[model samples]
Target: MSSAGPSPVRGGWLDPRKPFKDGVRPRKRQLGLALRDLCRLLHSDEPAETGRRPLKQAEAAKRLGCTADELSRYLNDTRIPSQDFLERLHKEAGTDAATSGQDVGITLEALLSLHTSALAERQGCEHCQEMSGRIDSLIQQVNAPCPQCAAHERRQEVRRRQLRRRQQRKLAIRLRSASKEQQTRLRLELAEVKVTVADLKAELAGKLATEAGLRERPAAAQPAGAQLPVPRRPGDRQLSARDVSAARQLVAQAEELDGSGREDLAFTLLQRSTAELLTPAETALVVVQLRCRERDRLADDLIHVYGRDQEKQDVMAVALELHEAGAPNDAGAVLRAALG
Candidate 1:
């Protein structure tokens, strides 16, 4: 005892109540969590007004006059509802001003503010840091793992490959078409050469016969190069370059208008483009499509807005008449199907 080594000091490592600085703080409370709590309270099996007879999601959506998907978003979305949505929801859910947490003395908005302040206080306190970290760790443990979208990416890759194949096939077709056109030109040139040779041979023979006849009788009054030229095909008329350029402009305008959601205006421009650029037959087909689409809209409007019950029948009669005429693949059939 007399020779005891100085005063025995016990100083190993001891865990303090406070945590170290620079640790991850607890996550802020999410609106989804708040909504989840409310939904649980509303749909609780025990001590709820509905009790054992719980309202199904579909039935609740039906009562609310919205889709079940929409109901899920309204009740479970992480984002706070807009003021307009809140008021509309208040009306739909029959949550009165008195019961919307003001009179009940418990409000989600107020609770959120209070919780934010409390969390801030804890985050600033060294003594509470350990508790915050523990709670965050536990919450993370309860979270579901993220799902991978690799299958979707694979599907997109397949679609892109299909598109590339289609484009390649189209390019091959165009090359084949050009080759066929070149072959056709070569064949036509060969035919022209043969015809020229035949003409030259005939001329030589005619000259020889003429010379022989002239030598014998001094009169052979007939030439063979006086044949009339054959006429070309009926629709072989070519368009001038100027006309094509004008038509292209109209088509560009039509596409622009279509992109802007002015389909009616787009139809007008397309009609103009066809009228200026296309043959009569091509124009007729375009007109058929436009008229058919318009006829459907007008027919429905006549019945609903104008109260003209016979308008559809009248339109059908006109279409049938056109079909009976040589226009059987006719605008009328298209119109009837569209309108009906």
Candidate 2:
């Protein structure tokens, strides 16, 4: 404790002549400063008292065949020049001295070497090495698949298929149930149409009897060749029994098509029945009922499917039509339930 150890160096305790540890590289700022200093030395006039003037930055850029901005950026260490540009710069700086019969200077080579060394030092930096490692890890991660995520995706796909099958089965069952009910309803409606047709025939016969009685009373006052004009009954445009039977057959076929999921064909058949066979009231009732049933089925399917906004739109359209056709209460309730 009494004896003093070797006196500390003036700047710090570390020896001035000691070398750095292995794999050490100069920092970017230190390298940049060194490069800038070398640039100044190369670009300055050779002798202080000789009255020779160094080229201005613009003139120097002209000699090097580059823009003043580019040269300035290179000299300030803000940009790294290409190898060809550096070679041209070196040649341009030395060309004047060689032509004037003066010794070419070492400054140009020194600056180029400093710039190259600075680049090398930056490339070898610890931060750069760490960045390189991270880039490689990212590349490997991108190339290789994760087993857990892959398995999870596979399981999700399987579950999706299973759910779709379940929904389709449920839809098919509902379609069968609806078809049976439709058939029963159509039979009952056909019986009613038959009864109505019978009543219309009876009414038409009564009208003919009255017309005959009036014609008989006027017969005494009429000429021999003149014929009486027949009166038209209200039920003259009503569907006949044959037309009703045809409509019933078409309805059955349409329901079969609907059950088999050929709804487009079913609708086409229904339209034909409406246009050619069923009376106006019968057509309206049948079409409305079919449309309502189809809308209900669509709603059920939409509940379990993806991308069903269009189906919902179709449901709204049908509901609106039903409301316009005089079932406002039923249509309003359907719309409310659907919106809910």
Candidate 3:
């Protein structure tokens, strides 16, 4: 007690040598430094236990559900980490530091902003880079063209194409071993997917051309004998018995998928079912079946498609009647249905 031992290191975690010791900025390199510092601090602060050895890098990586090599890349700014990994790190560090009476001085908001900037910058698209790290104006003209928006749309189209190809391959494999009834359903689904692919390809090509300043001139006026396309409301178009039956079967499949916790596929099936004309009764049945978060958007689309007042009223009335009759035969089914 008489002789004073060397003073313990104070605030060593905030060493000036660290890259983000001053502050965390919304940049890839800065984020990497911050993450590195955070990992080091957390690892150092972990208490030693009896008969237990801790390898700092491995333990830290294990806590964040990633490998040591991945962590090293993240720390070196050689690779960008996903949003989920960043979130996990923030949560773990916050919880651990709080218990140890230490402040890591990092925030999730800063990390996410950095991530967004990093992604936009990584794309190397001029418009995307220009739009990065700026708050976009909320007021956009209805028909105004945005190069950045077009870039994002094109990226989405690419992703959709990849997904469509993957689904097509899966369907092709299933068709070989599927029963006749299953084959019929699979073929119908495949045909629908093909039509969608064609539309997507056409739209993507138009977007690419527009971006490349290759817009085509308007076509010459059509002949007088050519009939203009007639616009019809949702309920105005008639669906055959075969179409109606197929829609019902899709609805049943969607319900089964939903029960099995496959909500994404279920919602897609629901969208496919509603893409065509449905009678008020069938629409009501779909309303009773839809339980996903996208139900509101689907309902709005339905209202837009079934635009006439009479048709809208009929859709609502049928939905209500089904609710009253316990159509799905489940307790509180209506309460959980899209209409309710």
Candidate maximizing TM-score: 3
Worst 10 residues of 2 by lDDT: 1-10
TM-score for each candidate, following the candidate numbering: 0.24, 0.29, 0.30
Error of 3 at 132 (Å): 6.0
Lowest lDDT 10-residue stretch of candidate 1:
9-18
Question: What are the clashing pairs of model 2?
Answer: none
Instruction: Tell me model 1's lDDT, rounded to 2 decimals.
Output: 0.42
User: Per-residue lDDT for 38 in model 1?
Assistant: 33
Ranking by TM-score: 3, 2, 1
Ten consecutive residues with minimal summed lDDT in candidate 3?
1-10
lDDT of each residue in 1-340, candidate 2, tens digit only: 0112222233311223323334334433333443232233234345664664545557566767788777655544335667687666556545554544444334555556555655765567666556545755897899899999999999999999999999999999999998788667556654554564456557657877987887877576777897785764322334345434544555565666678776655555554344433444344345445555564443233222211222455345545544667776545654565665
Which has the greatest lDDT? 3
Tens digit of per-residue lDDT, candidate 1, span 113-199: 434534554457655555656766887866745445567778899999999999999999999997687556445533443454355
Model 2 residue 269 CA deviation (Å) reads 12
Query: Candidate 3: global Cα-lDDT?
Result: 0.55
Query: What's the residue-level lDDT of 328 in candidate 2?
Result: 66
Off by over 4 Å in 1: 1-148, 155-159, 170-174, 189-201, 204-340
